[model samples]
Target chain A: TLLENPEGLKMGGERRKITILTSDLRGFTALSERLPPEEVVKILNFYLGYMADTITAYQGTIDEFMGDGILVLFGAPTVREDDPRRAIACAIAMQQAMTPVNEKMEEWGLPLLEMGIGINTGEVVVGNIGSEKRTKYGIVGSQVNLTYRIEGYTIGGQILVSETTLQAAGDEIKINGQKEVSPKGVKKPITIYDIGGIGGEYNLFLETNEEEFVVLPEPLP
Target chain B: TLLENPEGLKMGGERRKITILTSDLRGFTALSERLPPEEVVKILNFYLGYMADTITAYQGTIDEFMGDGILVLFGAPTVREDDPRRAIACAIAMQQAMTPVNEKMEEWGLPLLEMGIGINTGEVVVGNIGSEKRTKYGIVGSQVNLTYRIEGYTIGGQILVSETTLQAAGDEIKINGQKEVSPKGVKKPITIYDIGGIGGEYNLFLETNEEEFVVLPEPLP
Candidate 1:
């Protein structure tokens, strides 16, 4: 479960650098309107089950499940040197996992689901929050909210990463496109990269500061 | 508490047409980053307390609190003929209440806070969600998500309302400006009205299918 409290973890919050990932289903509200409540639960269960498995597999911590959206943290309760790379790899795997999940949806005669994911690496206060009666082990920071805004800019099946994340992940992840966006409340425009894949033999493009791009073929003989 | 369930409310879900209001404190996450955890909690408590009081004063139900954001429902557990109008009035009151809140923040030597509110009226599935051990009396629907999207377009101290809300509010409220927005997942462009005040003397503009506008003076003297 996303709310699990690991043993020996401090109840007091700690500030740490972590990569936060937020993903939400596209058109889910519209889709849910047409289905019965029980059906909505089934779809959410199947979808979240697959996603939770993928996150755990990558050693990422599931933060909270907000209706059809999921907020996840990488490098919490424990830190990994390759957390950024792990986050990107985990995102790709989740995208790949969507295929089977969609296949099941088709069998059930339900509308196919698409997701938009946003990842950002930054410092956040993470640990138990709230009063004694009701406490939640979660993360809070501007980066957490930025991850949501970045996810907002995406459509179905798109994974967007902030410049900080791209720099941390290095050349291991390939990029399909890039854009600068000024999300509300943020002081300045941020450069975001549309992730393609992890070290794939795909065509890459080089762009000049003037916005001109040259396509470069990979694995050229 | 936003999650409080009043007496006699059903644990089972029900369908109802309620006005949903979502508001978020602009730039709060950035401001919190510079403050300590205890200070952050203090600010949230102060802000949310004022908001919760305003919502309850107007007979609205607080659904959930999302970090710096709050989702509220009016016409739930009971229906009111003037729920939409009450919601708009409540939003205006909240904006007005911000002045005192900001004053207090200034006295505390903290950054002043601004909020953006979005209201939408539509049918939603409401009642207990989750297992018996952990059920929440909340709302679910596309309209709930649309309210969030509408809130996204607002800056600080702005209240944006959907067409449904406008229709329900009728001539009881005055609007200062209007714009058409195509929120993500929404099929087409929607005309959103920027609310000015309730039953106030203000200039209003009328638009036609061709996007032609005619300005009319307040009270049509």
Candidate 2:
């Protein structure tokens, strides 16, 4: 039944500052090409499964999943002062959740997986979009693109966050390193920070002293 | 509040024969680059909104929407003998739906939109994926890849159906033209049919004598 006056959807959009999160498995695409499709999907299910719960726990709204990649929004349907912090916490938690996922994969004779998460905080047009009859929470901005670019820079098991997110997330986030890159479509060089952990109330950290994953990826355009 | 025994959750995947549909807008990506991202999303909402409702009305399970593209399943979580027929009818309905969507775009002073739909049928692994805590129905197979390849052959305003889908849908489907292309990764060249309409119970047809849209797209890989 279609409602003539769909109460939830308005034609226009609202501009608001929000945190964007994009995560993808490193080397998984090539790995998927080698394995059977079912096996590939099985690995993805386990990885995306744990990540979904972790993101929901931190109040992040999952926007969509493109194959093995996931895009999450921190403040679209609703806003929170700690949206950026929560996103950071969620990324850290997601990284930690990988241990159990990998363990399970090992038991099943599947390859261990590693994920890279990127976060950016910026103003975007956000709203209940996708026509009047459906409630598809949609957001769009250059920040969304930048988040994907930043994720592209990450190696396996790494979290690369934009400086804007760093500003919003505050000083609790522990940065191990930083890099400047001029991502495609961006005019100027921007700095992105590699984060190891966050402190204060939601204290969390990426596993330390782990062998570094150095697989460089072709940056996403 | 995680349920250890999620009633509908099954760890294993099920193999099933199903129909797959993928559709996308042509040249929209290049056109969108010139507009603001918010405007891009606004245009997408109207386009995807109608498509969503149309697909739902036909009992198609929307797998996901990647930007302006949508992947739908006709027989997953459940199946029917006439799934291929339903997919054909749904594709015809989706192509015809572009009329109203474009009209709204014109009223809003936005550029008109055109869509191409493709359908294919084959066996695949389908199941309630993600995790026991969440019911994310997922599918993966060579058929899924082949369906994408078939959709990649479509031009805007065209409906392309795979030979497999044609055979499954029976003779009620109307084929306007056919082409044999060896899409990348496929071992042998497969024939795809350009459909004009479907006969029988759910009668649907594309408008006759419409100006041919001549823009050729670089096939999706």
Candidate 3:
């Protein structure tokens, strides 16, 4: 059902404020190498099915699937005032959904898979992006690329958000930590926040904060 | 045109021995962050245009464009005996074409852009990848993911190939150096060859070879 939307195939493009989220399965390449092709597909399908369901439930659009990576967009063709909030919530849900997905993998004798998510909110050109014969609804802009760079910094099970998303998402979202990263191609170092969860149901694991409390012995008395 | 072919949209997929080439434009994100949206699109179009031309010239298919990255395939739709060689040769040509591309960027008062290419040869599932409403010809497998991991190790202007690709490409392709990288997901360390050029016309700059010459000084007595 994710790829069955007929309205997404219409021609032309437009510029709008949208939130883009990119998620990549960590260590999938190595895991797939050791397994049979059908098994790999089965495992990937099991993982991606949960992701797709969660994303669609939040009204997010599945732009495309890049093998073990996925590109998703919010606030395209349909816009909501809380698109950024929805994007963050959807990401949180996806992260939590991995529990059952991995459980299924365990039953199938497949290794557990981890995912890193990066979300950014900005203006982008969204529409059907190919020629007359074939085209798919997609969003493109520097923000999309930025989301990718931000995602590259994340490890397994971490959700990272750009400053713009943090600002727009309001104060309800908790921050586990923040990183000032100068990713390749950006002139300035942008601060990215590690999202802890929204509301009371989810728990926050501050993995990046361990180094901050490192205590050195009193100056070699 | 690259996106105009109707034959690439059929349903179902096939497993074939195709050469996958993944290239990413280095620092384009930082560069785009400093420029206007229109200007960023202009520069990207300029760079990707040259890459498309070279790939088409080599009879390769432009599978998909991942923002600043590209996933190309050879021996798809139609297979060729020299698909591996064509991939390597196309990579070399793409590296060579950067000079002109940089010149245009310089003329436009923009900084130079660098690209890293990774080529791999193996069996992958290639064919229409999505539902019938919207399907694109693409390749997916461990080899495809391995190509991405291999490309991750490359710097700007460098071409890295897997052992499989190097073996199938024959001796006409010159190697600058080789590295044993244990990329995540792979159980064992794999050797990746840094390709310098193809044929006698191109030069091989052994950037990876410099470290091998480290000489230990005489032990202090």
Q: Can you give the DockQ of every candidate in the order shown?
A: 0.11, 0.18, 0.07
User: Fraction of true inter-chain Cα contacts (below 8 Å) kept per model?
Assistant: 0.15, 0.18, 0.07
Better of 2 and 3 by lDDT: 2
Q: Write the per-residue lDDT of candidate 3 for residues B90-142, one digit (tens) a residue.
A: 89888877888888878788889999999999988655543333345656678
Candidate lDDT scores, in order, read 0.77, 0.80, 0.76
Q: Please, what is the TM-score per model?
A: 0.68, 0.70, 0.67
- Among residues 3 or more apart in sequence or in different chains, the pairs in candidate 3 whose N, CA or C atoms overlap within 3 Å are A30-B185, A30-B186, A185-B30, A185-B31, A186-B30
Interface RMSD of each: 9.2, 5.0, 9.7
All candidates' chain B TM-scores are: 0.84, 0.87, 0.85
**lDDT (Cα, 0-100) at B31 in candidate 1:** 79
Model 1: per-residue Cα lDDT at residue B112: 88
Could you say which candidate leads in TM-score?
2
TM-score, model 1 to reference: 0.68
DockQ computed for model 2 against the true two-chain complex using alpha carbons: 0.18
> Candidate 1: misplaced stretches above 4 Å?
A1-15, A33-38, A56-59, A76-82, A125-141, A152-158, A169-221, B1-16, B33-38, B57-59, B76-82, B125-142, B152-155, B169-221
Model 3, A80-184: lDDT tens digits are 998888889899989888888787778767788899999999988665543223334655667887899999999998999999998997656888889899987
What is the CA-based DockQ of model 1? Answer: 0.11
For residues A160-184, write the lDDT of model 1, one tens digit per residue: 9999998998565778899999997
Model 3, native contacts kept = 0.07
